[model samples]
Target: MFEQIKVFFMKIWNELIITIIVGFFIRSLKKSKELVKPTINELLNNIDYNSKNWKEEIDKVLEIKTTVERHFPEYKDYLLIQYGSSVIPDNKLPSDYDFIVLLLGYPIEGNRYMHNKGTISDESNETNKDQVDIVFRDYLSFLFAASAGMPYENSVIYNGKLVKGHQGYFQWLKNITKNILFDKDFLIRRFKEKIIAEKQEFHKCLKECEEFGHDEYYVIRAGYYYITSILQLRRIQNFEKVITQNQVIELSKVRSFYEDILDDNIRNKYEQLVENLKRNNTLDLISIDDIKEVLLYIGEEYDKNK
Candidate 1:
């Protein structure tokens, strides 16, 4: 509860900063920005894109790097994953394929989530229904949050191969999440009533990818979308339960129950990002035009591959 209050204030602080930046011109704006703040904006603007040095941490986790480039190539040059700590310092990069997709996504067709109450305009304690816990949140979702304003870890792609990790590799998108998006005919029938809860929420996650600037964050979070995918094992996890009882209960809901995410510090960061987006008027910054560009890019790429 106290942590929530801290989160509330942090969010406030961030929004204040954004408003100051967007509302008026301050000669000291650049100096006011957080230095070494571990934000995507900082990384993009500061890092030398030509750096040859990168993470050589893991010899096992393979899925990390390839996943980033495939879905989020814009960040291909900057993302990397290290396996152990102490071997490295002050650069505690997240898992190999961090910051891939968007999570805490906006609403979609059906599934709706929680919201915060009691506030004064931007100062309110609003919690978007989409706020899933960080651990259960698909680490990539966490990565996306981190990448929004921090430096994304970097890596190099070699003929579609990684320098190290092999067994740790994984599928691109979650099977369930993908199937929901595939949104076809017979495929829909096969899925039948299997949608336990928050079906629209699935699509919302996809939509969030586009909304959140469709940068390195989307690619990283997309992998964790696979977490939504463990739907295949839902029946067994739930002991032959169907429809997840209500909207909230699910066999895999357990995944979203990680306590690590509830930490005040993490929540503080989440609040800050929300505040920044709101203050910068970056919250819905991606428009219909951006969506069109993305669709066109995807189409052209698809055609070329074919």
Candidate 2:
């Protein structure tokens, strides 16, 4: 696999860099809980296993099938990537959307559930909001709910949701927001709202970066700045919950707390990405020696921080 990957990128390094950078914006491998969050399994959901609303949600979602055909034509071929239903017993209103959308993986494409990144941070950039995430089998084993039904939008490459216009996308939301789709009929519309909020947060962060004197031209750029900003907020929020100010004695720590959030193998792959960026002058198609210089430069950053 390593040799195959190297050979694959060896042919088109530029495309790889552009992809890694942008792809990371949406497909970031979030560190899942090794042990679930401090919540009792009870805190994890909105309803008990048996609930009347859960049945209602299924009825509502099924009714929206017409909306998809009428609004977005993409589902004309897409399949049921995932079907789940569950209830969050506590009845908390919600901080963000609850549904976790994922595209079916294997070949890794087509109809799939979408990750609600918006709920994670409340920033809804058009591009990020439009992402259609793929899921590995058994990845989120939590999907056995008896009621939730989602129409995973098609994989979006750039200009728009593939084959479906904004109308199709709106149908997707209308179907879910009805709150009649989840097993417990828990409302998951908060994700849509949060995505919008995150985009606003990013604009705020970018403005701060500029007002604080970071050059907007170089300092504030790309979809990544937006993604990283949300990541920062999540870190700050999660850390605040368990660790206090004293715990943050290491003020300059970067990506350390985040290290645990993702598995080592995935994190290591990102490290290799940094190496490739350094070694190959990810900006330029160049010789081996040029890449060597970049590697040395990256090494110095760690050394200086240490």
Instruction: List the candidate 2 regions with Cα displacement exceeding 4 Å.
Output: 1-67, 70-72, 76-96, 102-306
For each candidate, the alpha-carbon lDDT, in order, equals 0.30, 0.31
Candidate that scores best on lDDT: 2
For candidate 2, the 10 contiguous residues with the lowest summed lDDT are 151-160
lDDT of 1 by residue, 60-120 (tens): 1222345433533433232222212212346453311212222233333322222110001
- True lDDT of residue 177, candidate 1: 25
How far in Å is the alpha carbon of 276 misplaced in model 1? Answer: 14
Q: Write the per-residue lDDT of candidate 2 for residues 1-306, one digit (tens) a residue.
A: 999999888879988888889877655444344434432112323433276465334323322234334533343322222211122235343222113222222322432322222112111122221121122221122132111222221111111122212345334533433333222112123223333455565456556665785423221222222333333334343343233222222322323534633545434433443332222223223322332333234324323532
Q: Any idea what lDDT model 1 has?
A: 0.30
User: All candidates' TM-scores?
Assistant: 0.22, 0.20
lDDT of 2: 0.31
Worst 10 residues of 1 by lDDT: 116-125
